[model samples]
Target: MSRTKSERYFFLDDADREAVQAKGRAHNRLGLVVHLTSLRYPGRFIPDPRQVPTEIVAYLAE
Candidate 1:
């Protein structure tokens, strides 16, 4: 099972969490994809499908 943003980044500071929540409200799918991919590739840009992992693509399809 995949962990939620809060579960995955339990140590996030208040400002970071608020920023993430703001992004969540603006880009739901993108947020999930970014969060999942960031676990493996931190500080990397994920602007589109070509940048994301195959596994993340499959998960997004569902």
Candidate 2:
């Protein structure tokens, strides 16, 4: 079976949280996804192809 990516969230500072909420309330909406990337790998054999960057795929594997 295949594994999927998982995410962890960190809360913003009180002021930033308030500002985000205020903007959402005023606009009657929320903004786009502003987030970070976290990756996990499998046991010995298989590599996570998603985590590999385009520029140096072979070098990374070697």
Candidate 3:
């Protein structure tokens, strides 16, 4: 008979969970465009608006 591998799960402690929640709330207040981009590119946050292409910004505006 073959043995099945067990799965592991990890969880955040109360303090860590609270800290993450607070950070998420602050990020949400930055506006929809910011929130969307952050979700799309997890590594990048608050990229400079001036450096972004005008066409992209216009698209996001709509």
TM-score of every model versus the real structure: 0.29, 0.26, 0.34
Model 1 lDDT per residue over 1-62, tens place: 24453244323446655556665454574565456546645555556546655555554433
Candidates ranked by TM-score: 3, 1, 2
* lDDT-superior candidate, 1 or 3: 1
Q: Which pairs clash inside model 2?
A: none
Pick by lDDT: 2 or 3, better one: 3
**How accurate locally, in lDDT, is each candidate?**
0.50, 0.29, 0.41
Could you tell me how far off, in angstroms, the CA of residue 3 lies in candidate 1 after the best superposition?
8.8
Model 3 TM-score? 0.34
User: Which one is best on TM-score?
Assistant: 3
Ranking by lDDT: 1, 3, 2
TM-score of 1: 0.29
Q: Quote the positional error of residue 58 for candidate 3 in Å.
A: 0.6
lDDT of 3 by residue, 1-62 (tens): 11111001112346634545555454342344544454454445546646544544443443
Error of 1 at 44 (Å): 1.7
